[model samples]
Target: MIKNEIKIKSEEGEVFDKKQIALAIRNSTFDDDLRCSLLDDGILDKCQGCNLRYICDGIDQVVDSYVDKTTEVVNNFDFE
Candidate 1:
């Protein structure tokens, strides 16, 4: 994994712990498409079963919004 640091804020404007978020992302079973959506900056609108949903605030939307980049990063295992 690239192991770069990233910060994500919750809908309540609370910041998620970086290591916690990274662990969640690393262990997530969500597919590339789903993972992408979870990483987007847009409103998620839907995330029922995601463990990180509370802090991610619809990362699925973010991921979906950046389909090309997400796919590339995912394919490269940059976020592994």
Candidate 2:
């Protein structure tokens, strides 16, 4: 049997390369510099012709929407 792990950085719609990911895991850290060196621009773009595009896109939509709404709420807080 095969296992897979998915890490979603919805704030930035870019996917990291294997090396960057490995380094992050090994160092126990992830930062914007590593994130900027993306292997691919978008997950949906990569999954365009894939059979599981629909499922992946659906999940992306839900996550993106949740993040957007949460950010909006947080931003609107009266911190005065």
* Candidate 2, residue 9: how far the Cα is off, in Å: 30
RMSD of 2: 12.8
Which pairs of residues collide in model 1?
Answer: 36-63, 37-59, 37-60, 37-63, 37-64, 38-59, 38-60, 40-62, 40-63
Question: Which pairs clash inside model 2?
Answer: none
Q: Model 1: per-residue lDDT, tens digit, 1-80?
A: 55444555678775657675545554453552224455365545556775776656655444445454455543543565
Best by lDDT: 1
TM-score of each: 0.24, 0.32
What lDDT score is found at residue 10 in candidate 2? Answer: 52
Q: Per-residue lDDT tens digits of candidate 2, residues 1-80? A: 53243454556785545654444443332232222112265544454477765765665565455446555443555677
TM-score of 1: 0.24
Please identify model 1 stretches exceeding 4 Å from their true place. 1-16, 26-57, 65-67, 73-80
